[model samples]
Each structure stands twice: as C-alpha cells, then as structure tokens.
Target: MYLTATLDEMTEAQLLDHADEVSRTQRKCEAQVLRIAAQTAVLNSPETIDPDVARLPGRERVVRFGGVGTPDVAEFAAAALGARLEISSGSARSLMADALDLMIRLPQLWRRVEALEVKASYARFVARRTRNLTPDQASYVDERVAEPADGRIPWSRFEDLVAGLVVASDPEAAAEAEQASAQQQVARPTRSTEDGMRGFFIRAPVPVVALLDGRVQWIADVLRSLGDTDGVEERRVKAVAVLADPHRAVALIEEFAQWRDGSGERPDVDWSSVMPAITLHVHTYAGPEPTDTVRVEGHGPVTGEWVRRHLGPHARFTIRPVLDIAGQAPVDAYEIPERHRQAVHLMTPADTFPWGVSTTRHHQIDHTVPYRRDGTTGQSRVGNYGPMSAFHHRLKTHGKWQVHQPVPGIYFWRDPYGATYVVDHSGTRRLPAPEPPSPAERAVARALFGLAA
Candidate 1:
C-alpha cells in the first residue's frame, strides 16, 4: 500500500526504478528462504547424530543424498518443511538439496544469491542442474552462470552456455546424462483444455518434431488462403488438431499444395461438409440486438464474424433446438438420454472436479445423486449430473469425496480433508476453511479416535 499509493504520482522512469528495486527486495527474501533450507539440512544432517545412534535397530537413521557431497538429512526433515511451505515433501527435499548444493559446491553463486546480485530461483535452478558435477565442475558453472555481464539472467543465452559447460567440464558424466535423457520420451495431453482449447505434448528426436511443426504451419497457411480468418497461430493449432484424423490432415495438406501451385484464390469449398460432425448450439435471441456468439461443442463459442470468415458467408447453418440447460425434465430411465447428456456437456464442458485439468469429451457423466434401482421417476436428467473423468468419478464414489449439484451447472464437492470446493461457469474455487473445532469438540474427537490427548 505504501509504494502503490505513490505509483500514480511517479513518472514512467521512476516507476521502472521502483519495479527493479522491488524485484531485488523479492530476490533478497527468496535468498533468505533458501538459506533457511540449507540451515535446516545442516541441523538434520547425519553428522549431528551420535555415531552410536546412526543405526537405530535395523536400518540407518539419516537419509543419504548422493552426488557433489551435498548434506543428507533425517527422512522427516523435508516433511516438516513441506508442512510449513504448503508443498509436497518431495518438493521440499529437492529445495533443500538445491540449497545445500549451492552452499557447499557453488559458494560463488551462493554469495551472489545472498547479496541479491542474482535471483534465488535462477541460483537454485543452476544448483539443481550442477548437482551431479564435482565441486570443481560446479564451481566452473558458478563463475560463468552466476556472474553474467549485464547482471541479468536471460534463459536464451544461458541454456546453451550451461549445456556446453556441463559437457566440457565432465564429458563422461555428460554423455551418461544425454544417454539417460534419450530414454525419457513422452506423449500426453496437457492441462490447457479449458474453454475448448486443447493441447497434446509429444517428445521425440528434434528433427521429427520439427517436421511435424513445419507441416502444421503449412496447413495453417493453406487455411488462411482458404479464408479462415483466425490468427495464424490459431490456424496452426487447428491444423495440428486435425491431424488426429489422418484422412482430414492428408486432404487439407493436398489442398494446401494445390493452392500453393494455383492462382492463390480462396477456394469455393463447403468447409463444414469436409469437417467432422460438430454440434453447434446457435441459440437465437428474440431481442432487437441478437448476440453474435454461437456456442459450438468441442470448440466453445465463436462470433458471427468468425463463423462467416471460417465457414464462409454463404455457408448453410442447421439451427438445432437450444437445449435448456437449467430445466430439462428428468427422465425415469437410469441410463442417460443422449440429448440430456449433450445438454449437460454444453453446460459444464470440462470435468467437474477440483483441479481436474484435462479429460476428453467422452468422459463419464456421473449422477450427482446416485441412481437407485428402486427410485421412481427421473433418475437421470440434465440437472442431476455433469462430466467427470473416469478416475474422478470412481474417487467420488469410493475415495471419501462427496459431490452434489444444488442447481444445474454448479457442483459443490467435499473431500476427506474437510475442504470444500465448488465448480461452476467461472470454474473451480476452494472455499475458505470452516472455523476450528472448540475444546469440547476436540475432546470428543480425541475420545472417538482413541487419541492420547
């Protein structure tokens, strides 16, 4: 509040200086946190324990972390840190490892961190990367990486520099690392599937991935020439998405090649005829000024301008009955009706669970209230359910998580941890925790759980 109050009075140059100074302050705070982590590791180190107590009865007491002679800690040390940091124990352990590595192996970088000459995050990133190196090798990186010419850490310049140094410092270790990295290929969906956007990550040899990207861009250019008025980047995304259907990708690529060789005019093709069957919820308004946006399943909503540009001005439209999301009559059948299911999907497009990032369209639509065999009247309806990934659905059913929809298009969930989360049009939000239990309640809880309170 103090600085922000004066921001409006400050000139642009003054604002810039203020931002830089605040950034340095933030960096200093980060350094303090890392210093604490390093100190905590020392306190938990095996050397702190008596030699006789090193072995309790069956196993060694202290956790041993290898490489660069970074200090080891008691197994529960990270857990204690994690509780305070609101992070996982594994993450806390990595933080401790990175801090100790910087303190012991890269003392030059640690000094830079403490002085606020470099960001703590940047220092820790280097520490993690250089952890496998010997003290001399780590110091070699510390001098170059920590002491940048411009007092700034730009990833573009350092990425290659760090890689070259790592290889040059210890060739055999670098080779082993590269060999290990080659085995770590993966292909998976990403968490960016909100509001009909999608992504799939594929890691392979550089050349193969490069070619795929090149081809997708080529298709996007073709789409532009064909009067698809979306931005080039957006067109590229659509082009890549079409690759899921090999036949369509091939057709589009061939058309692109033909368009490249021809007069370069917008093709007079019916685009929708070539595209997959899309459920477009083009709900028309009775008001004088009707809305332009049409809600299309799988792709969310698009404006009339977009529709005209992509689908062509003369393109025909099929005006399906607008599914009333709020008040669909409940059907007696236990199995969901296709139209009802479609309406539910339109209402809440993504999986209706806290932090359920990516689930395909075909994900299970779980009944909010369980459908009983003996239950008379509408068991399966629009308001009764929403989309859930198979895993989430099972978890809700069996893993002590409960969900209920008090209204259509909104879901409230309670987990085993006594936290409440709600999912609706604006997306998921964790409600604030309830008031703590009273002493009387605590006494009862202790008695019920047989706790030594």
Candidate 2:
C-alpha cells in the first residue's frame, strides 16, 4: 500500500510535515555519520596499533602516531575509513578533516550538533567559513553563532553574520588578505573545445568583472531591442560578435580612455540606466584617524587604499544617508524610486535563483508578490523585491509559479505542479515533491511483492 500510493494523494500540509520530518532525520543521520568518521580517524591512528609492530622508531612514534603531522597517517586513515564506508579515499579524507576540525577547533559547534540542537550541515557551514580564521577568531565566532537560541537561521544570514564577525575581529588582517588575494587575478587564454565552442575564463577583481558583465549585457540588450528575439545563448553570442568587431572595439577603447582622461566627448551610454551601478562605501571613523577598510557593494570589504588607486581621479562620489524607516509610513508609487531600487540591488545583487547568473548584467526587478495580487509598491522594501533573470521573471509572471519571501533575501518558490523550493545565497533546496513512482520501480514492485502499479 505504501509503494502503490502516490505522494500527490496527500494534502499540501501533509507533504510539508513529511518534508520536515525527512529534513530532521537527515540532519540527525549526518551528525551520527560525522561522529563515526571522527571515531574512525582516531581508531585508525598508529597509536591504536602496536608501534613496534608498525616498525616506527621510538622517538618518531609521538610525531607519526599522536599528531596528524605525517601524510602516511592521513593516507592510512583515509584508506581505512574509505574501505569501511565504501566511499572514495578523497571523500573520506574530506570527512576526516571536517570531523577533526569540529572536534578540535569548534568544540562548541560540535557539541550543539551532538546534542541535536543544531543541524550538522550548519556546523559544517560554520567550520568551512571560519577555516581561514585564527584559532582565537574561530572560537569567537563559534561562541557567538554556533547555535542560535531561537533555533536554525537561514544559511545566507549565517554567512553574513560570520563575515561581519570575522572582519570586526581583525579588520587589518582582512584588508591585507584581500590585497594579497587581488594579486592572483588573471584572465586565462581562450580555449577551444572539441565541439568547436570557445570558452573565456577570467579571475579578476569583483568590480572589473562587474564592469565587463555589464558591458556584455548592455550589448545583448541592444541587440534584443533591435528585434533580435533569439534565445539567451544566441543573443550572448551575437553580443560577443558585436564587441569583437574592430570598429566597435576601437571606438569603445578610445571613448573609455577619453572619458578616463576627462578631455574627450562622453559617450551617450547611460550606465546606471543600462546596468546596475557599482557602489563603493567608505565608512567614516569616529576618530580622526584614516582606516584601510572600505565596503564594496556585492563584494564585501576591501582596502580604502585599493579603492583610491583603482578610481584615481575618475571617481564620482555619492553620499546617501541610511534611512530610518522605523516610524515612517510606506510611500505608494507606481514606479519604484531610484533610491529604493538601489537598496534592493545592494541586498540581492545576484540572481536569486541557484543558477550563477549575474543580476548586475541582465536582470528584472520583480515584485515577489504580484502588484495586482495586493503587493504594495510602497518604499520598495528588500523583502518585497527580488532581482530575477529575464527568463525566470517571465516564468514567475506568466508560468503559474508562485514565490514568497518569509525573510529578507530568502525566497520560497512553489511551482505550477506544486513542488516547493527554498532559495538563498548558498543555493536552492528543494522541498519534498509529490512525485509518482517511475514505471520501472512500479513494475519491479508489482513483480516481487504483487503490489498494485
């Protein structure tokens, strides 16, 4: 009867309840697995075996067996755990690292998971995010954010909170790290595939990527406006073709250099209108001393020195005070105000979907709830607005999909067929779907147990 019945037969509420149960059970199992993996690592240590039988020298025993100082011990542990768990050595090694980190550096987080007070995945999330932090800094984060008394928080909020704590712990260290990392930026040579497709890859500063993304999107939008109703891939191909043209390439270079030099005629391109504007925020220190840290919208914190060097004399500064909307009423308007739009863009600078599409380049500012469906366009709050790719926007508008924001920057989407999803900065998590059994499964069940198909 269980195998024969379909999930669609259950009500929405029932489905949700079952999904919650599944999620809880999965978290518990993950915690147990991590515990077992940690135990396995300990048991596989050379100390667990006879040192004399293992042929270790008397003085070398402590270093080789006691500590994770030797690669051979790690390899032995990985091999042992992999064989026991029927997994790859690489996977076992990763598990061992996470388990050891939890046991050693993040005892509080590990305790929370062991007690089932926090999800194992969230514990791992904190561990991974704080891996680069000093032990003292990691402990500080673990103490404050390992287990919220109110229960689980969204991964996106957790990340932001951790990042804030990390920067606050040592701003100078963060700035130095950022500057050092910036030196590694490079654009690799283009590669051609066997299928005759070419790929270009770049590892650069966020601001540089933002500019290039905006330019490509602008070209694509222009081509689309000129009655080029091609698909997304085709339109992007055409946009690159336009950019690669000798005339347009030379013209763009000359115009940009002129603009930079402040002596040539400015191009008619309305940058803010065409693309999401890049915002650099410098926080004024209370004391008269200058600080190195500056916050770049969508890119987190950077050194003030880096910002100054990049912008040089071509920088235009905008001073906008943070609005206190506490006692103020929401203003109703047919169009979202520029300030409000910019606020929404800062909150969700990328496409809300799990797909790694850029909102700065090509996106639509959409109301989470339809305006016709009692969505108030007042003040353009972040909770009510989301940036979606054009394709996703159309799906939400006319494809019978429903979306709601239970919290700012977190979206829950229900498809036309009733499958639900939760999306955040980390990625998308699908809720339980009321799917029918596949024909093969049904057939096998029928043949084996005489169950109804």
Candidate 3:
C-alpha cells in the first residue's frame, strides 16, 4: 500500500519506510554491478586473450582494450569496463581494479557482500583501500573484518585499522611510498572559476604553510578594522592580493600595528602562540623493528620520521592518558563524566545509529540504554554510551525506534515494523529479513510432508 501511493499521499513515517526498502535494494544492485564489472575484466584479461599465443601483429584487440603486456596496472587489462560503462578509461581501470580486488584479494568480504550481509559500497571502499596490499596482507585484513554472520561488531572498531595494517605489512614499501610522494610536490595555477576567481595550488612543507597562513590572517584582520566593507573571508582574499605586492602589504601591516599598540585591543593573530602550535592526533606503531609510518587521524598515512622532522621538539605535546574502554568501571552518577565521554568517543567515534557519522564534535553523548526513573547504580557508564546528534537522540527517546546493544559497542537498531540495522565503527549495515511463506506454499508444504501450518 505504501509503495503504490504517490509521494504526497504518503505520511512522513511511510516515506522513511519506503526509503529504507529502496536502500536495501540499491545495495543488492551494487553487488551485481561489481560482479558484472569483474566478469568484463576477466574477458579482457591479457592472460585469457594474448597469453603468448600466435605471435601476430594483427591481434591488437588485447592492447586496445587495456595494455595487455602491462599487468602491473590492472586497468591496462582492457578498456572494456570503460567502454561498457560509458566512463573514461582511467575511471574504468579503477573500477576494474576495485571489482577484481574484491573478487580475488578479499574473497571473504566479496562473498559476504554477495550474500547481502555486508554493504556493497562498504566492501568496495575496503577493496580500494586494500588494493595496493599483497595477497597475504589482504588476507590478514579480511580474516579480521569479514565474518560469517551479518552483525559483526569489530567492523565498527576497524577505523583506518586496515590502513595501519597495510603499512605494518611492509615497512620498506611504506618508506618508498613516502619518498615517492615527497618527489611529487608541486605549485601550479588552477583554471578560472565561474565567479571570475582564479587560485594557486601550492603543495609546500608544513612550516611554510604555517607562516603563510599566519601572515594572511594578520593582514585580513587589519583590513577589517580599516573599514573595508567586506566579510572576513572576502578580506582574506584581498589580503592574498596584497601578498602579491609584498612591499605594500608589509607597510600597511606595520602602520596598523603601530597605531593599534595604543588601541588596547588584543591582536587577532598572535604569531608567538600560533606559529608553533600544530594540533595533530598521530598514532605511532610499536615494535622491535620500528616502522617509518604513523597514521594521522584526519590526514592519511604519513611516515613517522617525516612527522618528527616537521613537528620539531619545540612543538608542544599532550599525550592522552590511555583508558581501558572495555574494563572501565561504571560511575554511580547520572551526569556523564569527562573520562567516560572520551572513552565513548574513542570506542565508537561515530553515532551508533543508521549510518550517522557525527562524533563528539556535533554529538551529545547519550546513554544508549536510557536511564530508568528509579535507577541510580552504574547507569551512566561507557558500556551503555553512544554519541548521537540532538535530533537523533530525541528520535530514539520519543520515536518508536528501538536500540539494543547485544555487545558493549555493537548496537542493533530496530524500527517499529521489525526492519533492523547494525551500527558500529565501520558504519551501519542493514540486515536481511527473512520472507514469510505464502498461503499456497504453506498448503503445499502441509500436503507434501504432513507438517503443521
């Protein structure tokens, strides 16, 4: 009835229900698409088509599709995927690689996706991340992340865990990658924008960026006080234009500083405090054989040595005291403790609901299992905690949506109609609901085997 109704005819709840149903189907279709792409690559593989066969110059289909001789770049296997998908050859190659990576390197994950237990996009993302890894390295990743059952809890906890594993798997390779990336530093002008604005793309070292950004902000703030009738950001753009004429820029900033000495207003950009303050959350690995790599939270993997070199000893450090997330004792009070909040954020960085990615920054830490009126003991504990946006927290508290944490961090969310989703560190995934038998099938079963209806 909901499906047959027009959009305007449906209620708010009905629209949400329809959306969930549509998302499940879309995931299933994504799996099929990956399979079809894999088959396309197989058909175009150099081994299959030009494997030292009749040495003839005319047999050039294999080369035209993908450079058959260069198996190192899997995209060269053929342009077949690109051609069929009506995409660029580069995009086609990346697609082919992802599909093959899922099929071959991570067969376990691939199977779970095809079974509709894991999300296809989730699997595809993991595939791309692990594509550079060797078979053994990929196997190490798959063994931990992939599971037979649908609601795997560790999936939530593997936040960039695969990336850490990939780096740990090969030290020399990580170092070489770091060196290669260092060689690719560039500065170039970008194409003009619709608003007649042009920009420069500068890939410089951290120190240079810190100095440049600090100077730009200093000038922008001066422009603001000088009655430049532009917004702060607009002033910042004009400040960059001032930077192009370095002598004039320096003179204006100097005059402002001399006059502002008596104005009694604290300067916006304090170079003394700002220059050395580089806030980073870097995770370093420990072993007898030290690795060159460290995982920066927001930034991708960068070498540990490079971080030490860039963020010199003068840079301040605040090493977070480690807490046992699983073993922490529950507090007696209703108000969530600061320590407990940190554990909640660290344990499950994102909201423990339907694919919501809000962490403590935008989330109000919630007790996943709501506190009872008469309850007093250990109700505000890390084991019972989740970070949710205010709106979503209200939804769970008031809406018919129900959540049950079978394990400490793994949450199973069920809607009113019994459609369930599992949420954790890896993100949310829908569970496959079993279909009930029709009346005719029940009758046939009863007659054939004398089973009870």
The number of the candidate with the highest TM-score is: 3
Q: What digit string (tens of lDDT, one per residue) describes model 3 on residues 151-230?
A: 34334334455666667677667767766776778778987776777788988656556656767787788888777989
For candidate 2, the per-residue lDDT at 154 reads 49
Put down candidate 2 lDDT per residue, 1-453, tens digits, no spaces. 223446898767666667767767777898888888777766666555566655655332322221132222434667667778899977777677677777777789888888867777777766666666777877777787764511334455456556755665567787677678878988875766767776788898666786777667766666566567988778777767777796875455445545555775755655455344654454433356344555565565555666666654545777666544332334465456666566666566667754424646236878786555255446345577788888888888888888889877789888765778777655556675667889998999999999997
In model 1, the worst 10-residue window by lDDT is 149-158
Q: Estimate the TM-score for candidate 2.
A: 0.62
Question: Which candidate, 1 or 2, would have the higher lDDT against the true structure?
Answer: 1
> Which segments of model 2 are wrong by more than 4 Å?
1-12, 44-46, 49-75, 115-117, 147-173, 190-192, 224-233, 245-295, 301-314, 327-329, 339-453
lDDT of 3 at 182: 65
Model 3, C-alpha of 215: deviation from truth (Å): 7.7
Q: Could you tell me the lDDT of residue 249 within candidate 3?
A: 67
**TM-score of each predicted structure versus truth:** 0.48, 0.62, 0.66
TM-score of 3: 0.66
